[model samples]
Target: MTPIGEENRGPGLDERITGALVGAAVGDALGGPVEGYSPDQITDRHGGRVHGIVGPWHGDDWRTARPIAPYHKGDGHVTDDTLMTHALVRVYARVRDHLDAYAVADHLVPDLMTNPRWIPELEAEALPLHRVFLAEKWLVARLAYGHVDPREAGVGNIVNCGAAMYMAPVGLVNAADPAGAYAEALDVAGAHQSSYGREAAAVFAAAVAAATAPGATPDSVVTACLSLAKDGTRAAIEKVCEVAGGHGDFES
Candidate 1:
């Protein structure tokens, strides 16, 4: 292994970590309303810009869109993405060191269970994940009740982006050690995801850790992601960027 981005000379470690967390939160809130919309749809709506928090989509989009439970998320209401992130942060704060699947079961499961917060998407304050969404509720159930092994828990879960979507904090915590971050995230995410979701989570953590490197720039970050990402994830990103680039909107 090349040790991924495990270099110590990277500058502004604290700033990079903070940026990653805050950026994820802010971006989640901003993108929440537009989550289901396509790029063209987003452009047509919101005047091509989400200047601030807005309500759910309107008009035909609303009629055609998948049913969102108890609409009216209001401005800046966060979804399970941010909620999972905060739970992970609390776990890190308590452990104050590296984590594995057991730590995820002991700390993260409890955090998701007892820590009640306003779930804007669900429009209710309740236990995490499953209570938030039946699909997500599996995370807590498997670890807390089913007593499954954390490392293998994700084996049957849906193959989606749910795991990868909330994995940036692991990358930030591991900082320059992309490999370590990827390993830990893979372990932690196993309780909630499987297949492509698990793969994406590991790659996302690696990318974040890689970006936290000293003197890291935008191009360098993309390079790191391409390097660390494997198989489908790597090829998908390259192809998407290349295709998206043709439209001159890859950055959008």
Candidate 2:
């Protein structure tokens, strides 16, 4: 098992894991309506963007994968990020321990290929057939080296936030152990994302681990994210905090 409690321990074991997964899904749905659109665009489209839990979340546009429907325009639909997180959750439910790179690659690569329902709205942007083949090739390479060569792994048109967005669940399973979460997230995310993309995945994973601790508030989770993220990501988090703060209570 990926050991937790190397440092501060927060929640009960089950609660932490469950809370992390639930929180990630909630965050994804909360942000889904605003996905891809800038703040200005969102304001222009909707009189004012709802801060949290807006209703009538719609599927993303096939062409742009941006939320665009009237009234229900960009509300709270889950994305590939949350779907892949569920996939990881399934794997953890089965294994109940840390999985090596090859095992993770075996599960993830095939899922990416055949799981048409994983993220229905964004299927139009799924990896092309050739990239699927390449992913398989890199999976083999990953098996050989115990880690895929970053150069060979992420070379394709499939680059995006897809891999990073779903990574929170991995950290949830390894709650209170930021290092383990970071390591596992890096191993899995390496198959599909690199550079800043990989970094983003790692940060989110770390935050999940932190948030899973008992009594951890949203602000604490955001602080954990700030601790793990790089300058750009930290800046983004700051901006999000500013927006969240300005909105007062999000549920209102």
Candidate 3:
């Protein structure tokens, strides 16, 4: 295998980085409104598969809606996913090096608590902490307030994608280096996730790293993820691929 930064076979580094970042933000915005809806629900609500940006699920009642109230979810608004992605980028900028749990404690937690930015969903500028869900809030609660060890801070939190959602930057930083990305993500996500949640974060980062590699293909990325993934994460991806293998058309 080519060394991480030594490969020069596919898109240039600049292009790959730009594509990954822009793609993540765009995808996040597109998925915001239909985030928790079932496929059939999304299709029904959009009058078909969503082809472009749409309005909040409850339209004018968005502010008073029962479940998603007080936050606008669509019309190009990004959810916490993109907010955390941007925060990871800022952490990368400040550190100028690979990050770990300590970096989360020293940089990311502070940023979420102190930085007030334009929250599209909120349609207002506010601290990221205000918009992030309770899972993310665990970071500040555990690290800044509880003063738990960064590496073990995620122990009692719910196991979910709170860490994985923003891990694209880890993959990008470790571009072309799936193994490195997986290891680094394990360390970084340790501050925010545990069990399969952390495993998913590591695997997703590896998948991104593999995708950014020179001459990478979808199959290659999947192979890299399968190789590094563990427990239910591996089984779930395998099952998805197995089920998908029977269908060639995504729109069917």
Most accurate candidate by TM-score: 3
The count of backbone overlaps in candidate 3 is 0
Q: lDDT (0-100) at residue 172 of candidate 1?
A: 89
> For candidate 1, lDDT tens digit of each residue in 74-120?
36767777888888888888999988778888888788777777766
Q: Which stretches of candidate 1 lie over 4 Å from their true place?
A: 1-11, 49-51, 58-66, 120-125, 244-252
Off by over 4 Å in 2: 1-11, 52-76, 115-152, 155-160, 215-252
TM-scores, one per candidate? 0.81, 0.63, 0.92
lDDT, candidate 2, 134-157, per-residue tens:
334454344344455543465452
Q: Rank the candidates by TM-score, best first.
A: 3, 1, 2
- Checking candidate 1 for backbone clashes, the offending pairs are 10-214, 11-214, 130-137
**Can you write out model 3's per-residue Cα lDDT over 1-252, one digit (the tens) per residue?**
777876656678789999998998899989899998999998888899997899999999999998999999999988999999999999999999999999999999999999899998888899999999999999999999999999999999999989999999999999999999999999999999999999999999999999988789888888888889887888888878878793222220
Write down the lDDT of every candidate, Cα atoms only: 0.76, 0.61, 0.91
10 residues in a row with least lDDT, candidate 3: 243-252
Q: Is candidate 1 or candidate 2 better by lDDT?
A: 1
